[model samples]
Structures are given as structure tokens and as C-alpha cells.
Target: MAIRRGRGVAAINYPTGMNLGGDPTQALVHSTPTGNFMVTLSSVDLGQGMKQIMAQICAETIGVPTDRVVVDTADTDTGPHCMGTFASRGTHRAGNAVIQAAKEARQVMLEVAAEELEVNASDLETDGQGNILVKGAPQKSISIFDVALSAHFKRGRSISGRGMFLIPRSYPEKETGAMKPSTCYAHACTVAEVEVDDETGEVTVLTVKNVFEIGRALNPKMVEQQLVGGSWMGISHALYETTEPYYPNRDHGGTDFNQYLMPGPGDLAETEIIVLERPSGDGPYGAKGPGEMCANPQIPAVANAVFDAVGVRIDTLPITPERILRALKAQAN
Candidate 1:
């Protein structure tokens, strides 16, 4: 089965001031400065390739490179008012919203370029590296750099953009929104192989192969990293990471590093991550959300793999040997 976590993951990231159940999902983002055609955003991409994904989205929309675009996610006081980092909504929700806003900001500059080049804004082309070429007259061109300078010096308007959007914008009759359209939906499936010692009742994941469908892999390196890390996280959730709430099953409380037993690098199996290529019409540079989507279906995959290996069904999660043995005994009966 596919990992269907888009809405659930989207809901968890909102802060206390924002209501997940409320109409619109919001972003509290702030742009730093425009060195050239570059702009910044307030999504601190820890490791899920969100930074590169968002940068690609911006560059494609506003006509710049991955390098010409910058993002500043530090400092909560200054950044856009956003739901704190939890659900992997960074690139999907925030990326599209900001890209839409940046396109608005670049509209003014594009108009300036068109006027200077003596052509319609739609007729001009942005080669995505600061170069704007007028149709049929490449010589008659303008750099976004010059446009920025002119916008600042000649027009006397700050070349910056700010925007806010709430996902699933469902509300009362006066509501002015709808479910914020998702740019893309990243999808994944995993296959696991495990070994269970019949005598010791211990199981180890022998191998894990994951295939992910991510729209327009902006940066292959970053996408690979996200898939690998996200697969490992799912593996941990399946094998270890126990969420005990007000229960005394093992005479312990919540699962920290000590209580939890996440697999180390040594414990990790031969992980093969396959990236599916599909261009999303709504995504920025065809990028979709990857992290949470990859995590959703993993537990079921691992459980199915265990059943495949032992010829027994372990319904309860965290397939410990004790349960496997109990299943085995019941099967024998």
C-alpha cells in the first residue's frame, strides 16, 4: 500500500496560534535580501532536501538558478509565522506558496524588463540564470540583476515578497478559500527482508529496498539523501521507536535514546532507494513532498516482509520474537 500522509502530516506542523482544524494552513516566512534575482524563505531544511527543493521551485518560477536563490530559516522572531517543524510540509506547502508570492514579486521586474526590451512581458524569456532574452532578439536582453538595481534605484520600491496560505482552506460561508492545491504528491513503497532466529526469537532486517516517486528531482544528490534518511526513519519506527502514552508495559515511560532502540548505521540493511521521475504541473521545478510520504507505508511493508519470512502473521506492531513465537505456537496448534 502507498503512504498516504499528505493531509495528516500537513496538519501536524502548525503552531498553537494556528489551528490545524481551521480553514487555511499558514506560513510565517520572511525574506532576507535580493543579491541578484535571489530571495530567501523561512523554512529551515534540516536534512529532508527541502532547501534544494524550494530553491529549485523559486528559480523555476522567478527565473533564477538554484545558486542565485537563498533561504534563511533561522531565527523564529524574524521568519514568517509558521507552524513549527513537525510534518514535512516545508517543500510542498511552503514552497508553492512562496513560489507563487515570488512570481508576483518578479511580475513587476518582468514588466520592467519587457518595457526596457520593447516587448510584451509574456514574449520575453528568462533563461533561469539572470539572463532575460527578448523574443527574436537575443541581443536585446536585460539581466535580472539590472532589473533589481533599477527597481531599487529608479522605481524606489523594495524588491521583496511576502505571502501566507493555509492548506485545506475549508470554512464557513464567508470563507474566501478552498483546500490549497498541492503542488505535487511524492509517493513510495518499500520491500523488506528479515531473518528470525528460531531458537533466540531475535529478528534483524536483512535488506530494505525502497522506490519513491518524487516529481522533478531538482537536485539528485539531495533527493537521494532524503530518501535514504527517510527510509531509515521508517525502519526505526517499524523495528524500534515505541510511543508509550500513560502505560506501564515495560515499567518505563516514553522512548528516548535509552528506552528506544533505533537502528544504527551498522544495523541498517542494504538500502536501495529508487527515485521515480514525474513532472508535476503544479510543483515548483516539479518538486513534491518526500519525507513524510516515504515514512507512512513502511511499517506495513516491514510487517508484511516478516510474514513472508516466517510463514506466520504478527498483527501487533513491533514484531518482537515473543509475539512471533506465540504466533508460531498458535499455528502449531
Candidate 2:
């Protein structure tokens, strides 16, 4: 009985957004009388830090601090239309829409502030901290809060804007299946190290080293969290998840957690991630989607690692002890 170790690598290019009629998303931005900004969107966050990233983008675009920006993820009834959250399009699609909305709102804000300050609209700049100042004159400035109040009460104007993002459809060539599925692509490479128990045919994944070109991390901490979580999900899918195995006989299947074969937190492997920030031209502030691509290369990397360790190919999933043992026997014969 010996433990064998091996390493394997995989590279993948994942597209962002779907190819269904130029996936579209919408956003709305408005300023309150108190100078705070509000953003409304129909896209759901799903615990992926969507709200935080969107807020940051809105604040930066409108020349306000992050704290002054409020994100309201309203449902379909009140918010604008969205093409759902899959295809890793939330950040790229929704964020861009928010930027557009903020640009419009900022124009309104600057116009109103210019009227009060008696200066040209183009000569005013935001300090990124809720204050609008004159160009080349830091001392001449007005708080956004005051501008908001005047816009509503004295000027009879409302500071609000709307935006929608749509990726134009790329028609496929008649003879070839050449079509752009998404506006941009996020790239990833994963190398996995694993150990195999020759006697029991059990495999243990030790580490996953990853390099990702995510087109800029809107929230780096959130990106790291998704990468770690997605890696585990990939490992679980590659090794333990099965809906209907042994189709003819269903004796081994269970309807609950106890009966299902899945990896627990105890089975998580060490992950080292290197994020390369290459902004996308079409993305908001050079940002791209990073949610779904983290798990893509891990499955293939693990499969190749198993092949390198034991010199046997288990084409099917889970890489179970029985499958390994059977493959070993076939090799011996």
C-alpha cells in the first residue's frame, strides 16, 4: 500500500453573458434631497457582492463617495427589465447600465450646481466626496446636499437618470458556427496536485493553484471569495455529485443529504489564486464578470491529475474507489 502524488493543469476561456438576442440589463439612478444617491436594478445579487460593486460604480461616476450611494435591488415590478443573472453577466451588464444612468444624473447635478455657482457646467468637477468644485479652484465648491435641496425647492428640477445595456447580436456565418456569444471573455488556468492511495483507490486533492484574467476586480475580496467557493463546487461536482447513478438499480440512492455523496467543508483543498486585472473595453470601468469562470478549469485539472497518479483512466465522475479498483484490475489483465 503506497500513496502516489501527481500534478495536472488546465486552461479555459469563459465567455460573459448569453447569446440570446443581445442580453440586456437596465438600471436607474436618482439623487435624494439629502444629497445621497439611489440606484435601482432588477438584477439579483445572489450573495455575490453585486450591490457593493454597483454602488461603487455609481458613486465614482456621479462624483460621490461610496457611502453616499445606496443600492436598491428592486424586483421586476418596480425595477427595469433584466435578462436574468446567469452567463456571468451581472457585473458587466448591470454595472455598465448603472454607469450610464449615473452619467445622466451627474449632468443634471452639474447643470443645477452651475446655475447656483454662476459658473459654466463644464468648469465644475466633483471631489468624489459629495462636493462640486470649480475647475482649478479647490476653494470654490458646493456640497451636493445643498445642490440637491436647491434643485428640488428653488430650481424645480429633479436629478434622475435611466440606463440600459445591450450587447448587439453577432450573427453566425451560414457555413460556420462563428458567433460572439458574449461581449467579453474571462480566462483562467488551474493546476491541481493530488494524492492517490493505491490500496484503496481513493484520491485526495491537496492544492489548486490558479491564475485568472478577470478583466479587473471590482471588489477584490469578493472575487477571492467566489474563486475559493467555486473551486470547492467544482471539486464536489467532479468527485461526488450524481443525480441518478446505477440507473437500473436505485438501491444506493438517497432522497436526502445523508444518502447523497457530496464533499463537506472538511474536504476543501488549499487554493492559491493570482488575479490579473486586464480591464475590458466594454465593461464598466474596465471590469468584467468573474463569478462562473472560477469553477471551469478545476474539473478537468482534477481528472488529469488522477490519470497521472495511477496510470488508469476513469472517464466517469466521482472517481470512486470501486471505479479505480476496476480500472486497475483491467490494466493488470
Candidate 3:
């Protein structure tokens, strides 16, 4: 038999934030005398660029450049309380907290700058380059560093603020199980193209095309990287990874990478991603988390593609050749 090619598509909706006590997260923001700002949080990054995303959120909220915002995360003993980083809550929860704290700190900085310039705080605006200027009179401006020095040395005020965000938990109707568990949901659709060898039952993925409505893209590059990595992880799980070769009689299982099988770069399919921004009401700057949702539709799409290719329904995981061939033989019989 000849090799056959097929395509399949899938769509998924992924929730952001969890339902535990409304999934609260806190942030602390303060300005240093050197004019830099720091945001402290207990949420861990876990290689998902939490620090960079939070810094972008804080800088945008406080009207400063991202470089001026430093994110200090993962120090539980020193940082404020946070729900652990998982379930796609890092950006939405922590970013909102930073927004609240940075807003307050920015207000304080404006007031201090107003006093120094003999102007009303409402008439002052920051240039986002460490400078505060009188609105409509850009020529009359003061460096944020000078204002910070005056705040600490002359005004005896600390430019610090604290903030916390908690989504209100809702009681689900016992009969319907309907309740708001997440503040926002990210959506994605994926289409996978694959070719299957009839004789060998081997599948080769040719391409994966994805479109995501992730509320916002605080860091487009990071979003792209996540999609690339997550797609591959999905591929590995769908076709190459399994721990229990024999369930009741476990074998070939161990605690090392050598014992595990996973797809590498050679297995990656060509990917095309389209990001759509439909700002969420609850997220900071309308940014719904993107890390977890990247892989949501990939596995199903690949599985569907396999079915389309071979006209057989092999439901088990890894879709090993033995299973495919067995399904084919049954179909023929």
C-alpha cells in the first residue's frame, strides 16, 4: 500500500487562574534612590519569562520603561504571598498585582515631583524615561532620580506600595456545576498535516498551524517560543512517550532521561502561528496567559490527522506502530 497524507484540526479553550480561594497573588513595588523600580513577588518564573512579563506590565502601568522595572521573584521568605506559578496564572494574577502596586508608587512619585517643581501633582506627567514634566510644558521637567532623592532626603517619604489581587470565588450550583472558576479563558485552534505509511504504520507530521486568541501579547517573542516548545512537547507525548509499557506488570520504567523516549528537534514540524488579541476584562493590560495553552489543541489535532490518514481509530497513546497495525488488520478483517 502507498503512503497516504491527511489533515485534521482541533480547537480548545484553556482557563486562566485556579479556583482556590480566588487564586490570590501579591506584589510589592518600591523605587530606589537611583531611580530604578523593583517589583517583588513570590510567584516563580519556571522558565516562562515571568520576570520579563511582570516587568513589562509594571513598566506599562507605572509609565516607565521596562528597563527601569526590575522583577524579584521566587524568594518566598522575602517576597510577598502568591499562589504558586501554574495553571496559566502567572501573567494574569501576578501582573495585576504589580499593576496595582506600581500605580500607587507612581502616584507617590508624581506627588513628590509636584512638590519639587511647585506644581500640582495632577499637572505632572512622566515621560517614561525617568523624567517627570509639567503637562504641556515639556521643557520644564525633573529627573526621577532627583525627585527620589528629594523624597528620601528632603520629604522624608518612602516611595513604596503594596498590592494584592483575588478573584471572587463563586459557589457553583450543585445541580448544574456551573460556576466561574477562572477569570479568563484563552482559546486556540490547531491544524495538523501528517503522512502515514500503510505497511509500517509510521506517521510523519508535516506541519502544524495554529491560531490563538490569548487576550494579549505582553511579549510576542516569548509567546512564540512557548508555542514552539509546547507543540513539540505535545508531539512527544502523543507519539513517543510512555512510562508503563505493561500496566499491571510494569517494565522499562526508570528515573532517568536515558530510560525515557522523547522527540528532539528532528521531529519538529513546520509551525505557523497567528496571535489574536481580544483583551480580557480581568487580566493586566488584557493579557491572558499563553504558556499552557500552546499545547492544548496540538495532541488532538495530530490524533485526528492519524485517523484521517489511515481510516482507523487507534485511541491509545503514543500511537505506536503495533497499535496502528493491529487496528488496520482488524479493519481489513
Winner on TM-score between 1 and 2 is 2
TM-score of each: 0.77, 0.95, 0.95
Give the Cα lDDT of each candidate: 0.63, 0.89, 0.87
lDDT of 3 by residue, 179-276 (tens): 98886999999999999998999988899899999997889889888877887777777777788755566786644787677876677789888889
Give the per-residue lDDT digits (tens) of candidate 2, residues 1-333.
689998889899999888867789999999999889999999998998999999999999999999999999868787888887888999999999999999999999999999999999999999998899999997988999999999999999889899999998889988997877777999999999999888998889999999889998988999999988888877877777776666567667657898776778788789889899999999998888888989888888988898899888888876777788899889989
Q: Model 3, stretches more than 4 Å misplaced?
A: none
Compare the candidates by lDDT and give the number of the best one: 2
How far is each candidate from the true structure, as Cα RMSD in Å?
Answer: 7.1, 1.8, 1.7
Q: Is candidate 1 or 3 superior in TM-score? A: 3
As for candidate 1, its clashing pairs are 24-166, 25-166, 25-167, 28-80, 28-81, 29-80
